[model samples]
Target: MKNIIINFSVMIALLASCSPATEKKVDKKADSTEVKVNAIPAPSPENNTVLKSYIPVDLSTLVPIDVLNTKSTDVYEKYGIEFSGNCYSCDLASLSITKDTMIWTNVCDENDTFKIDDFSYSTEGSKTIVKTSERTYIITQIDKAPIYELVVEGKKLELNNKRVSRYFTTKKALSLFKEHDCGDFEG
Candidate 1:
């Protein structure tokens, strides 16, 4: 009986020494060897389209303002446009230049003419700038199309030409088909 009690007591003490304590302790400093997660952002719809590079060229390098103003010039033209969404209307807009006049016509046959001398002309790098009392116009010639940047007060708006060459020569040499539905607007 004495031997049995002694062995049992020894076994209990060994187990008690080997077992973990019930108390819990938290460290004040954060662990350095923690697992980190890096999140990647989702791709946007606008990022999927191919982007075109634009390099501005000097205005005078393409055509001198003197020659352009000497004759009636078609500054810009846009036609055969179909609006998106609920707007199912087709519209057109045009800008024409003459010796001492500038004319613009838009939807609903609204037209406006202004005198050339009413605006001051200057060139900044590749842009030909024309400034009025309240508005500023930046014109850049690109290939057949010219881009127009209009600045009023502090707001800026941009517009581009749709058609540069509207005359087509038939293969049969029948006649030169001219695009006149847009009117006598020419550049």
Candidate 2:
């Protein structure tokens, strides 16, 4: 019995030692804050570097000011929702939705402005529709993101909540639209 126990212990020790070792290679680059692990490098925890990337803002985090209905006002609170690509035929539109007003601006006539009223909200199939005299917007949820589709003058442009920069006032939104290039809208 003693011999059998000794043999089993020896086998267990041998098996434990025979396991493959994980290769941990840490490469530190000069003049850089990030450390390289294997080939994919990530921000080091020690440096506390913030990774700059585009993250979609949640609509539930909006101030929740009830301008129209709960559904319409929800969409209205999002700031700086714009089309993601280049459209040469039509001016790129950036929209900022406030508690009381909806501000829409394009590349051309950055100085000029117009106020849209006569707002109406409805639902068609899976889409929630908001319309003004100037344009029509269809709101729908695709995956986890709410998609805002603007239909104006027979041209359709899609804006997503992913580009929303911050929950800002109407003045800040208007200033950003006027100061920045049409394609250069950050929010």
Who wins the lDDT comparison?
Answer: 2
122 in model 1: Cα distance from truth in Å? 2.0
TM-scores of all models?
Answer: 0.29, 0.28
Q: What is the RMSD, in Å, between candidate 1 and the native fold over all Cα? A: 17.0
Which segments of candidate 1 are over 4 A away from where they belong?
1-92, 107-117, 144-187
lDDT of 1 at 45: 28
- The lDDT per prediction is 0.33, 0.36
Best by TM-score: 1
Stretches of candidate 2 off by over 4 Å are 1-90, 98-100, 107-112, 123-126, 133-135, 152-187
Q: Please give the lDDT score for candidate 1.
A: 0.33
Candidate 2 accuracy as lDDT: 0.36
TM-score of 2: 0.28
